[model samples]
Target: MAITDIPEYAHLTDADIEALGQELDAIRRDVENDRGERDATYIRNSIRFQRGLELSGRALLFGSGNRKIWALGAGVLGVSKIVENMELGHNIMHGQWDWMNDPEVHSTGWEWDNTGPSAHWKHTHNYIHHKYTNVLGMDDDVGYGLIRVTRDQRWKPFYLGNIAYNTLLMLFFQYGVAVQHLELGRVAAGRHPNPDAFKQDLRDVGMKIGRQVGKDYVVYPALVGAVTRSRKTWLRAITATLAANTIRNIWTNAVIFCGHFPDGAEKFTRQDLEDESQAHWYLRQMLGSANFDSGKTLAFMSGNLSYQIEHHLFPDLPSNRYAEIAVRVRALCDKYDLPYTTGPFLLQYAKAWRTIAKLSLPNKYLKGTVDDAPETASELRFKTDPDQRLTATVDPATGRRTGLRTAIGKLRRRRSPVPAIAGQRQAKDVRAA
Candidate 1:
């Protein structure tokens, strides 16, 4: 891809960026060359630990009547599932440890616990999403083709409920992920009329989903209760699985969202990619991603997405190496005067939700960018609305500033000055209509 000509990235010319890419690539090569007994032992031990936790949790659920025991079991099982999906599954499928020459642990050979198949996820996530990063029209991950996370997107009133629906989406996050690759949103919007096109895909994915569901809710519980012929035991096992899955879903969603959508991350239009350069691509990855500040334990849990900048730059690099490169990458960004988007985990979590909440509005700036214009408009700027708040300007169809007239009318009526939307941050140098 031609590097983007965006002036912000001019700090590093195409050649400069290429040299930087070489420097980063050397880091990966070093990790690749050094991969040996230590890496192998680490992964093997992690897997064993996860498996042991899963088994112990299942065993404990047999006597889940003890609230403390059930809590412990569920918590442990959730951690195992999280690690399996985030650290092991995500990294392995990135071909991070493929240098080990171990077939079973290789990206092509390993299967994850999620309902979504690894190959399908790799296609959508690794190939498409990573390649596109934050390109508005191309990247399915920009709001995952769901809620609007940026102001540029032409918004409809439908997004008003995204705050609620997004929560529900998180509750069933794996299910959302399973169908994200299908681009079903396009079908819903009537962009793709041929429903028959994805029939076989549906069957294949359905089987995977079915297998996961059966394992957690059916087969394992059936066996546990079979020995005693106790319906109570079966119910307990089912509940335990539900608990574990819920915890895993919430956590995975939180970590992933925090890395991509938290404050300081910007969204770009497809126009930004015209003649995109390698430097531009690298710049987008850096600017569009964020990290959550965390200690070792939380970093381990996040699959090192807390170092999302490092991961995006060298996706195929082993997870352990990300933390190492992160310090270097941060220094490079600082040298170039680039923004390093990141914050505390809980703080970023709140920002993601705030983004979901505020973006559920008609883009106030849409009039300036989009052709199909609305008649009425206002101008507000964003500064502190958890996420960036809307700042409406004059109507796109007609560059009329009726907002001032309307604001004056409202002032004359003195009908309890419209309490500036609560917790809303007005954009810089912009004001209410």
Candidate 2:
């Protein structure tokens, strides 16, 4: 029941969709043309800052016998890893800084600090995830093939542990990402197409994981133990590294969930991608992604993913430029009367969690119909009455366009006479009917 006709769900005509795409294309061109010194300096500075913080943290860990120093060292290292993973590694591998023609920042050259192989990540994330966005079966990121984040996923007994699964996924997010490309479930079921290729990929992941484990657990701990001549310090060093990696994993998971699984971030069926145009693709990105409010520091920490809508629109654009790009994208959303799905950081993240928690149950236990649920909706929701199907219209008073957002507002009002209960009965009635 996920959206099958995007233009209808968005209440936009073919011409309007094309026009919106043109404006978005223009935004891309402007940013591409304006990429210059400031952008280069920003990335360079980010790299230096991350490296410096990491060194400081490692140095502090040498004195990990002191409790306060151990905590401080772990915290600093965690933040450093977050910055490296989100800002530098993720963006660089997106080809965001490739225009600079600097191999140091090039997508192909930068193997990230995470356990996942850069080559595998590029294929899975940059190519498949971005290209497919939220198309149910196509984008593995739709719950990462673990937890059910949307009702479009048929409920199974396995999903009853949605919250538990998500918590574990959050804690060991890097490992989850590393194994994502392998599709372990398929291989376990003997469904993998190429055994030789799978073996090679598995080797690559194994090597990366070994290197990561050795660097954090063995090499650093052994070095600290030799220098400090204390077994306690060596054990503390390993724990410190563990704490840091856990912090990074949790934070990274939160940011990604906030941008993706929130209420307004709609899912789609493969039918929607059939013969999809550039404009439709842009539209899909807008509808399928969410954002969270953030200041400069928060934005930087999130790799400018606070502007997730814009990032999806122009994945290869300089990450630092997403803030400005968001301004234009929001304006376009206003012009076309589309919803710019965003909210406070905590609120957006909470919504994502709420969806996950609720969707663990079967449809019979849920309140909303498949076509009108908070986490899963389709254009059919607007076609209850064929003569009065919700669509774009012009506001006579202000000469402004009124489309999906306006229609949604009207639908909510119609469903809920009293704000307190807000459509509970109506939704149930609709489901029964």
Candidate 3:
């Protein structure tokens, strides 16, 4: 789409720009001075985090009472992890951990880690993801074997299976990432010889399913009954686990999905990145990344404001600084002629799903289909279908459609003065329709 064709939403005027600058300055001050430290918001967020930790601890200590109860606790815990992954893990990864520096600024196990804020997610996310947001060859965010995250894969004939597999895995996310990462480790170590590197995923996912069955069938019930006959503690543990796991998985999946699978994000091949500069890569991270609302309780409970766009741009910046930089980012985008895309989180999430839907459909372009196939009658039929064709029939004199009843009526019923045709012109109305 052309730049001129972009629908005019709203543009920042010089005055608007100046006001935003002042706002950013004030926010920066509040951040540096920690003026909001004791504010109700801070206290509230602290309480939520503490409660999550406490509940998760309870779940870990005791097993759930029955099979059904255990599943419930596990689901809830997954959701909590989702929230924490976005709010807490993302925030700390973004270095938002400095909001309260009582915790040391160590890189190893800081609050910034995605999976407990360790260095692995940091390296994989910062160095790899940001550096190569959508470039298939380098960015793990895309071709992570079983976890294909974008529609660009559909064009390949072989990618049909990958798309189907990814769909199911997205619903069961925790296992997906864990298994994918494990497979990635094996492939990186030169342990797998399959050219497409799919055997590793099969190996990891199979092992995980086996382990889950082992735990559910043998380990959990046995351990719970053996430890105590009291079912109440088990019930509490069951609920707690479900709560934690549910939050974690949902939050992580949502954040990751929103980052690249929606509007304003690009899917590039190795060729697209070959000529791109470092600044170009940085812009992709800024424009391609998105943000979502953590909601009142959710933000406090989860730590999602970290390493978002600004963090991607400047990894050293603490996570809490994200909200503060938003206004400044708007100004920067205007000044630099960049597109800064922001919206409510869930809305963008729907956009991601829509993107997937569009890509997953049979339409070639939407499916990210790379067409190398020889054209056939069926292909031509879809392409030339009248419903999809573009047609324009217009009046010869005025370049307007005259065949419509309304057009003819307008021509005859108009009270306005009409211009006369030349001497050679016919008296009849000329219809190009």
Per-residue CA lDDT of model 2 for 85-197, tens digit only, reads 99999999999999999999999899988999999999999999999999999999999999998777889999999999999999999999999999998999999999999
- Report the Cα lDDT for residue 144, model 1: 76
Measure candidate 3: CA RMSD: 12.6
Task: Score candidate 3 by TM-score against the native.
Answer: 0.57
- How well is each residue in 284-314 modelled by candidate 1, as lDDT tens digits? 7876788989888888888888999888888
lDDT (CA) per prediction: 0.72, 0.93, 0.49
User: Which candidate order results from sorting by TM-score in descending order?
Assistant: 2, 1, 3
Lowest summed lDDT window (length 10), candidate 1: 375-384
Backbone clash pairs in model 1 (N, Cα, C under 3 Å; residues 3+ apart or in different chains), count = 13
Residue-wise C-alpha lDDT for candidate 3, range 28-104, written one tens digit per residue: 56655654444335534653864585466445535565556555656654544554455445545545444445454
**How are the candidates ranked when ordered by lDDT, highest leading?**
2, 1, 3
TM-score, cand. 2? 0.95
